[model samples]
Target: MDQVEKTLNQNRLVLFPADQLQPGERKLVKVDQIEIAVMNVDENIYAIRNECPHQGISMIYGSISGTMVTSKPQEYQYGMENELIKCPLHGWEFDLKTGRSVFSPNQVSLHIYDVRKEDENIVLYLRRSPEKVIVQDFSCNHK
Candidate 1:
């Protein structure tokens, strides 16, 4: 593995005190040269990349709301309440639970990290993919 990848895989960075962020609030953190947006939704912690895929804007300034859909005229369905984050610049909605864009769930997505409570601190796990390493090796050999 590359040195950076190895270091990331072995590290579990403590972001902040778990109680620092109140429910329905978000905070921005930097780790390994990447900006991460950490949120507390209904007491559950979620972390995602801070940049919006559309315009590279900071998603930490975005607004949070529920997922809304319409099945028919004048019939609107509301679900996944308080679990959606809308980009402040372009209004792109992302599901905090799955990190998928509401408009293009299949194609567009946000990079999400696993967050957990380690004692009184919030810990973030930087995940690395073995498949990515294998792909890099295959490309290097072909080149």
Candidate 2:
């Protein structure tokens, strides 16, 4: 038997097995000295920074839930369930997909990385610069 070849990309990190983290589960991982919160929200995996913009607390420990929204002035509607991560200390909620603050989107935001399922491995791409987010997909570039 021969050894199976893995990914050649240096920026890609094999976080864990796909079966290890089920839907609605969260795992805290560190890559290049940065703490990241990898969550499986209804099987749509999302990765966000563990640091909160407010008090610099660990966001991974924050409660996962939705907030109330309203279109009319006097109406209140609950929306965006399980898509927001609250700051454990300050109760500030941030969207997992966009990594932006719910109340003040432009003012505060978390650094989010690209994540996907590569075969049986859950991979995350560590992005150092904003412009170099996706220069190319190595897996697609090759066979």
Candidate 3:
């Protein structure tokens, strides 16, 4: 009998198509060997690290809603929309524009990346080393 061989390669995951998401939806995207959360806030797109720094949870899987659309501000801004993502576990609110944690006043922000639409595809490039991996735990990658 011959032993079966198995190996895991990360290059097999498909993120999403450019048109799969609409304005106000968030999608988990992996590109350039990086995992991130892509969000379409009022037609403008944003890409940030999918893992929440607080507890290393996948922010993409969390409960996300447009803060501007759901909770309107007292004063209106020129380019402001409901684009805040609230963590379902701990209820940490983050502003999609700056990726800053609203729950923290001291500039706790997520790792942001440069995302653009190229022809018919949405592309995201790594801005820096991924601080946390949302798909796996800190000490384990077995999953």
The whole-model lDDT of each prediction reads: 0.71, 0.70, 0.57
> Could you give candidate 1's per-residue lDDT for residues 1-143 as a string of tens digits?
11122353554656567777667666666664677887777788888898999989987777778777767888989887778888889899998878999999999998888787778887767664222211000011100
Find the candidate with the highest TM-score and give its number.
Answer: 2
Which residue segments of model 1 deviate by more than 4 Å? 1-10, 70-74, 128-143
After superposition on all C-alphas, the RMSD of every candidate to the true structure, in Å, is 11.4, 9.5, 10.6
Compute each candidate's TM-score over C-alphas. 0.76, 0.77, 0.58
TM-score of 2: 0.77
Pairs with backbone N, CA or C atoms under 3 Å apart (clashes), candidate 2: none
lDDT (10s digit) by residue, model 3, range 26-64: 665554466677776666777778777788777765554
Q: Candidate 3: which stretches are off by over 4 Å?
A: 1-17, 31-34, 66-81, 127-143
Better of 1 and 2 by lDDT: 1
